[model samples]
Target chain A: MHVPVLKQGDYLIASVQSVLSDADLVQLRDDLAERVGQFRSRGVIIDVTVLDVIDSFATRTLRAVAHMLKLRGAETVIVGIQPDVAFAMVQLGLTLEGVGTALDLEEGLAYLDRLARKPVKHGK
Target chain B: MENNEACVSINSAADIVTARQKGRALALELGFDGSDLTLIATAISEVARNIVNHAKSGEIVVSPMNHSNKRGILVVARDEGPGIKDIAKAMQYGYSTNKGLGVGLPGAKWLMDEFDIESKVGKGTTVTMKKWLH
Candidate 1:
């Protein structure tokens, strides 16, 4: 019911370990907060490849995770969403517009790295 | 493939997959290819799930498109339960009033050619979706 994979480094990386259930989704939200509560990072990447379905509760948690991380000066990225899952989302009219997404874990990490390296623009 | 086919019924979430399978079979028998049949089935499943999660109970109607191409499938799902009071807010990417990924309606809209949703507070919700077979 609970299997999480998180990357270690300047960024916090987490992945859902199994089928997402109503309870697991809630736990993930809490775990995300507890894990990144003290870390000073640029972003967090959550791999969702193993998840076959995303229900309303799960969506809410994802949004919460993003919000919590943002408050800590970090962004959230969701990766590896399956086609059926993606289709289901659209049918239900779900969108992750503000959150970052990648095709897989590698690309997600790269995206985070890219965001981390972006130079801040300021008036000279 | 005759256009004189229609089936409507109300079922629970446990029956959703079987209902979708039946719908896809009906579409295939009516000359829709595998891909398009799958699309219709998937859309039906998503919307039906919405009925179960949000409305609690509903009916699903599947009919053939009555157009010149004769290559379209129409699905209408209606639920006589707590209707969606805020369509615009529910349509947002991360705005889910229930416990889900909030991707169902938007994703279903993407799978088909046309999609429409109508609902009222304390009345019910109706979702009409159509997919053209190529």
Candidate 2:
């Protein structure tokens, strides 16, 4: 499935629409990471609400994508993980560790806006 | 589609989707819904992916089962690739011989109600798993 990545202000939003194959997930990661740099996006929101099964491969790939975007100086927040998909992911020992998550597109945009408002912190 | 069993040949990533799609259809038909159906489909994805990543080729057979009291879905993945030499070690987390997170096997095991693996070096491997409707 092709995931549409749209730019809003300084952030990118990728809304996944259907079941994704392994290759599709990998392609999305590469595409998002590349676009983050090209568009100079400040944050990215990946919406996976339509995905019913977030399995091991998908989980691992998404985690990697988040990290990749982080290194590109873009904050990543995964939004719209369904309740059922979340439960199944947990049951399969998959967790989106170290990745930011929000409820929906609006909340995700709000999160990015809040980050934009906060003063950039120095080394922790 | 009305049949109780479905066999999907696996080679590429698309086959994985097909198998899991078939699995989801069967699970839904068996009256499993919500997270339970997702669990089954996810388990199938993990196993089917293993076939694509490690075995290079395999087939997954999904069917419905009825015990004396409970009913569930059964999934079996078989491959004639380089089989695992150490089943126990392969089951451990963070142990991978390829470019994967090494969680597929154990994760699939965790999702299903029952899981079994049979393998022989230089021969083949078979993974059987089930998730019951509760």
Best by TM-score: 2
Write the residue-wise lDDT of candidate 1 on B43-115 in tens digits: 7767877887887778888877767755667888899989988898776655567656566676677777998
**lDDT, candidate 2, B9-91, per-residue tens:** 99998899999999999899999988888888989999999999888999999999988899889999999999999999888
Clashes of each: 25, 0
Q: List the residue pairs that clash in candidate 2.
A: none
Worst 10 residues of 2 chain A by lDDT: A113-122
For residues A9-63, write the lDDT of model 1, one tens digit per residue: 8677777776554456677777777777666567788988976555444565687
B60, model 2: CA deviation in Å?
0.2
Candidate by candidate, in order, the iRMS in Å equals: 5.4, 1.0
lDDT of each: 0.72, 0.89
* Regions more than 4 Å wrong, model 1: A1-3, A7-11, A17-24, A38-42, A50-61, A81-95, A114-124, B1-46, B49-54, B59-76, B83-111, B114-126
